[model samples]
Target chain A: MANVRIERLHKEFRGAGGIVHALADLTLDIADGEFISLVGPSGCGKTTALRIIAGLETPTSGRILFDGRDITRLEPRDRNIAMVFQSYALYPHMTVRQNLEYGLRKRGAPRDERARKVAAIAAMLRIEPMLDRRPLQLSGGQRQRVALGRALIRDPEVFLLDEPLSNLDAKLRVHMRAELAALHQKVRTTMVYVTHDQLEAMTLSDRIVVMNHGVMQQVGRPEEIYSRPANRFVAEFIGTPSMNMIEGQVRTEAGRPLFTGPGITVVLPRDAPQALPSSGRATLGIRPEHVSLVAPDAPGAIPARVTVSELAGPERFHFVAVEGGSIIVRTPAATVLHPGETVALGFDPDRLHLFDGTGEDAPALR
Target chain B: MPPRNAARLYPLVLLLLAFVAFPLYWMASTSLKPQTEVFRVPPTFVPETWTLRHYVELFWLTDFGLLFVNSLKVCLVSTGLALVVGSLGAYALARFRVRGKEAYGRLVLLAYMFPGALLVIPLLLLFRQLGLTNSHLGLSLAYLTFAVPFVMWVMRDFFASVPVDLEEAALIDGASRLGALWDVVLPQAVPGLIATGIFAFLFAWNEYLFALILISDESLRTLPPGMMRFVSTTDTNWGLIMAASTLATLPMALAFGLIQRYLVTGLGAGGVKG
Candidate 1:
């Protein structure tokens, strides 16, 4: 129902560890009805940004605009923002029906309106049977539903969810994830979800903001983040089995750019992004699925010995040891490769991600 | 527990029980005994003849009823004040981001550490200067110097144990901070309030030094000081004192009996999700 603009937010805490920067220079704009996810590792400031938007935490310096109005110093109750804490934070003394009606009652809604809203939310969440039960009397899944109901019943301008599905079991989390997506579709409220799970961000968010160590790494659509991460940290943190890194150097050889490393050499394409230093330290990153296994004697293949193989339902991950380091290759489950076997690892030229330097701040070549 | 372990525990439990229950039993039995049998050597474990004569005389012959009413009034007022002010102080100490919060909490307990005898003279002086001497209101306020600090010291931990996330959820759900405390936090701290209320009540009810020094009027005196009248210079009549003591303890016992269920729940049952 509202678009949010967070302008240059910064938050710091004077803790035992000195001045900790929980969030730094965070700025983003979420369109109305958009589902934006702030995804990163622990201590990455994703939750800090969400809390600041929810008015639960005050930013050390920044301005938060909701529908073009500054609400930076407003109390949470005045913000008309509903949040689902990761722990659910249900009122233990109240029954499920009361929990659903608490916000309405606080807003001075009439009795019939509160009853109608509670009944609608309970039915929407399929928790009608738990209307009279306390939070502790319900199971984990039931509590999660009630927490969601409590948030949804408020009908606030924006919804902030802090890893709301993190407490459920694997199956329940998946089910709830789909339900949350469906609910968002139904309500079409501007939602900002915070989580460290990349898969959830990829599957649910309209835009993903990747962050690390209190700084924004990148913000883009899921496919853009996956295929074109802005830096080495974002490249490695967004994928499972992590992207493989080959530390090497790039230089021009006979008018064709070339990458050379221990036990590996590849001739770069003529039109590859050419803003590199002619000859310098660079790292080549490629995802697990981008590498193919072939015979050792195949053309332009790097020879390696399989170190380990792990079965993962439909895919088999092969950990192979090259001369200077290792590479993980995700192959089909029926690949039938064994440890200590000699094979060739082939990189797809189109899928290769080249970074300019070896440090965490290294920018992608293109 | 296993039968053998439970069997071994019963005797020790009974011994402790008897050690505690014996004084209460003696007080009740002495209140029921005829004045003639009260001082018989080798005091009878049970009275030779049970009678309500002491209770009848204590109520009709003396100002015992007035003293009982004054004690109730003072204790109730002081306990109510302590609970209201102490809970707010404790909630702030537990939840707010005040600098030196640890020192502040310790200071509250430090206020309660001074002995009543040491404080009575200064309190009496202060009360007199403010035209508060010989009044039940003055005595109730004097009780707060000890009662409020004690309540805050204990109740702070109870308030702290209620998760802050619940309050945050309430805040985001259209409740103001004070409204959140009333709607979410206070409900979780009911057992703590009851426990602290009982302690504050007992502290004011049983206080004698300040009550004796501050109040000179017989009508304003509480039970603890009023009962001292039974001890004349020549002879100490134990029967009247015992009867008054037994009557004084009845309200406290009834209070505990009524809220004993809340005490068992302790703190929060499921305020948090996981």
Candidate 2:
């Protein structure tokens, strides 16, 4: 196992739109045997960062150190990295056994030894039945299993997965996520999985690196990131139902600070942080689950008109119109609220976040 | 689905098939007929009196067998060299980030489109300087001008269509760039190589202008130019020429029959090459 350290790596590609920055001064540290995920939307540079770690892409600047050794310019084969591509990338001409045995053969392992290793990995992946079948003969899930088996046979220090489960169907994707996590636990190798799905990052990785537009937004544990997002992007990007934001300003009212939006005003809690930005404009971020629905007469509750109500399994979501902006409020299935009905939105002061207008500005949880 | 409509289309389809097969039928029929019946008026579809005299003459009375062997040697050498060198060039075009790559690809194709007449004179001069005139090597080299480019263009497109992910996967699996190319990339290009190889071979086989200019010795003549010797200012032996043409087309059918299986089983399942 190896600890991977990336220091200020940058990657630029010249496209029709001129220079497109795929990775912008990115730095990350992955501890030995730890699972880390680079999570972002498309064009967010997360895949670029993963490819750079695998030595498949050259960084414009900075270095990648593995086990305290500089390997920035090393060839991918010399780096001892095994990667699973999003497409599985199985050799169609080879059978499942041959595909898995490819790396061992390249490393000059004996034929019998390679067969033993292939048999073991095939049994582990439950692809023993497919050993003699070409990749074209396998189903999508079977192909992914063979791809994983191919990487596992390498026994590399660091394993890189580039959205390996993204091509699977929804049910198989979830199943493979758990299988991959289990495989990581068994092997205890440093792994970096890249995905656009927030849930996959949250459930699979020990730490998640949230990125946007070639910039790192936050890097923390799943619950830590979910509860305390660093900026407005993270707050809105995470969670099942995205967090709601109200574009407003903070003003001092009667020697106390208050957040004022279109037609609503919220008095800031007295214990609000002193480093809260003094900017005139601030965004009030509220998580759907944190916004409790209450009677219209509740104190400190903003008046809202229920716009849409949706029931998904055991939970219910209510979209409420308040201050000329729509906000989603998640609640228990037992709660009944209909459109055109007026209700009060109870803000959880401990969970509420306030961000300055700019993306570079950090958020403060009040 | 309808019997009447099928019957109505039969005559048109048969007419088109006959239009296609008549030349082949005429060549065979004339090759089997005696010389006295070759130019008979009111052209008979079938030979009333058949004899193998022209075939006997094609094999024994002349050095045409040697000419046929020479054509095979030239075509096979040119095709083999084009596939090897052209595939390497195509792999470079598909994989590497060469400067002016688009312009280079376009220029390679432009070179292929040039007719043999345009390059044969220049080739003659170059061949004389290299002491390659009237040599099989010189003709094969001349054929490569277009053969290599045609094969390169076709192979480049096929290589590009193969996903680059396969090579990347191979590289990360402890294979070098060259190893990945040979192992993961080239195997997937079998179908394309077969297709392009036949075209390159045909280009050399049917090259009349260059063969006429490059080879003067009777033994070095290819089928196309060697058959031309039958139609002279004096008497034209249509029967022997037809027999020779019929004999020359068999090698192509043999070559196709040998490799048609790969064309059927090729493509899909492997990671895309590009």
Candidate 3:
């Protein structure tokens, strides 16, 4: 397996109206045997970047290097990468055995070698009984397995999966995600996976590349991306139920600094910046799990009116309105709170994030 | 009790059956009638006396056998050429981003929509200039204008229904574009190919206007125009005419019967959204 390096890659499509810059100056380094996921909202060019790596698409600028050799102009076959599509694009007319052997046959492998590889892959995928069946006869999950088997038989330098598990049902998707993780561990190939599902990105990837608006936001371990987001967009986009963002002004209070919004005020951590931006506007971000509900008389708590309470299994999510904005708090399912009731919302100072007045400005407080 | 949906459909089904089966039954019965009873004051629903004399006379006196062979040869050649050229063009239009591809696709459909009669005169002159008049090869070439457009249009839609991902997967497997189409796409398109072939064959087989204008040699005449020669100035042998018509329709009937299953499957698959 070889490591792949993408340097300042850009892709633009010229449509009837104007040029759509699908990918802009994307540079990433995928180490050998690394499982990296490109995750983002739809139309963010994550798939386009993967396609460019696979040689299915050409970049408008920049270069891609595989194992220290430039391969930007190579054909997909010459690139030696195997890609699994979201649709599990199996040849409908060919039996499973033929499908698995397609790549080997195309490369002019010996008949015995092709047969041996087909049998081995079929056994690994547990598709021996299905070797004679056409794709139309297989279930969605089965087709996906066959699609994976087809790619595996190629023994390529990198495994590129474009939302391979997205077509399966929920339970099957979870099963296949774990199976894919195990498969990657077994094969130890340099794999680049693309998906819009954050859970998949978090669970399966060794490193996750988060993107937005055709721009890479951050590439880091899942926890780093979730806990220490590079910007406000990354913070809001990576978490379930999303992080609560409150617009406020950062100002000095007494000896320490504090954040002041329309109807609430909270002191920042002691290490935080005392001098704020001249505009005196900032935004505070806190995850739902970081917030808590406490007794009205609890110390260092903000008083707020609870707007909605939803029971999600063993956890409860409380939407509390403190000032001009609302924050969600995950509490014990037994912690009962009614709508319109005044409650104390407590959170750790360390978990609070403060950004500059203009959201686009540098983050003023961490 | 509520009225059943089947009960509601009974009269419409009966009407459709009558509309379809009546002409076929009339044709068959007329073919079996003796010449004297064929035009009786009240047309006989069934012949009073069955005879094979008209069938015997057609093979013995007319050039029916030669015409049958000629029609078969021309239809097969034209259909084969149309399927090959049209399928390649369709695949290209469906898969490639050639310059003016959309325009080319539109032009093929427009050609198919234009009436064949309008081109017959120009085509006749062109055939003469090219030394193709009265030749089977010329007739086959003339049929291409109609058949190729038809095959191309239907096959274009057929190829479009096939997922591009399958071909891409083949490409990743080291198959060239042509190899992938031949090995993967064409197999899945078997029913479509058959349907388009049948359409081209029937178009050439049943065509009368072009054959009449282009071919004057009795040996090169197809079944339709050759049957017209049986009509005399004073008397028309109705039995012989019906026999020849029946004989001419047999091949079409047998062909449709053999491929009806594939035709249905093809139409269903080709028309469905990918």
- DockQ for all candidate structures vs. native: 0.87, 0.87, 0.71
Ordered by DockQ, highest first, the candidates read 1, 2, 3
Ranked candidates, highest TM-score first: 1, 2, 3
Weakest 10 consecutive residues, lDDT, candidate 3 chain A?
A: A357-366
Which pairs of residues clash in candidate 3, taking residues 3 or more apart in a chain or in different chains? Answer: none
CAPRI-style quality class for the chain A–B interface of candidate 3: medium
Taken over the whole model, the C-alpha lDDT of each candidate is 0.90, 0.88, 0.88
Question: Please, what are the lDDT tens digits per residue for candidate 2 over residues A1-366?
Answer: 899999999999987699999889888889999999999889999999989989999988989999999999999989998999999999999988889999999999999999899989999999998899999999999999899899989789999999999899999999998999999989999999899999999999899999998988899999999988998888888888998888888877787778888887888787765555666778888899989977677777889999899999899999999875899999889998988999988888777788876454455544
- Ranking 1 against 3 by DockQ, winner: 1
**Pairing residues by index, what is the TM-score of model 1?**
0.97
Local error of candidate 1 at A360, Å? 2.4
Give the per-residue lDDT of model 3 (tens digit) for A323-347. Answer: 6778899888998889999988877
Q: Write the per-residue lDDT of candidate 2 for residues B1-274, one digit (tens) a residue.
A: 6999999999999999999978988998999998888888987778999899999998888678888899999999999999999999999998898889999999999999988788989989989999888899889988999999988888887888888899999998889988998999888888888878887998899889999998888878888998888888989999999999888877886877887776454333212433
Better-scoring candidate (DockQ), 2 or 3 = 2
Ranking of candidates on lDDT, top first: 1, 3, 2
CA-based DockQ, model 1? 0.87
Which candidate's TM-score is highest?
Answer: 1
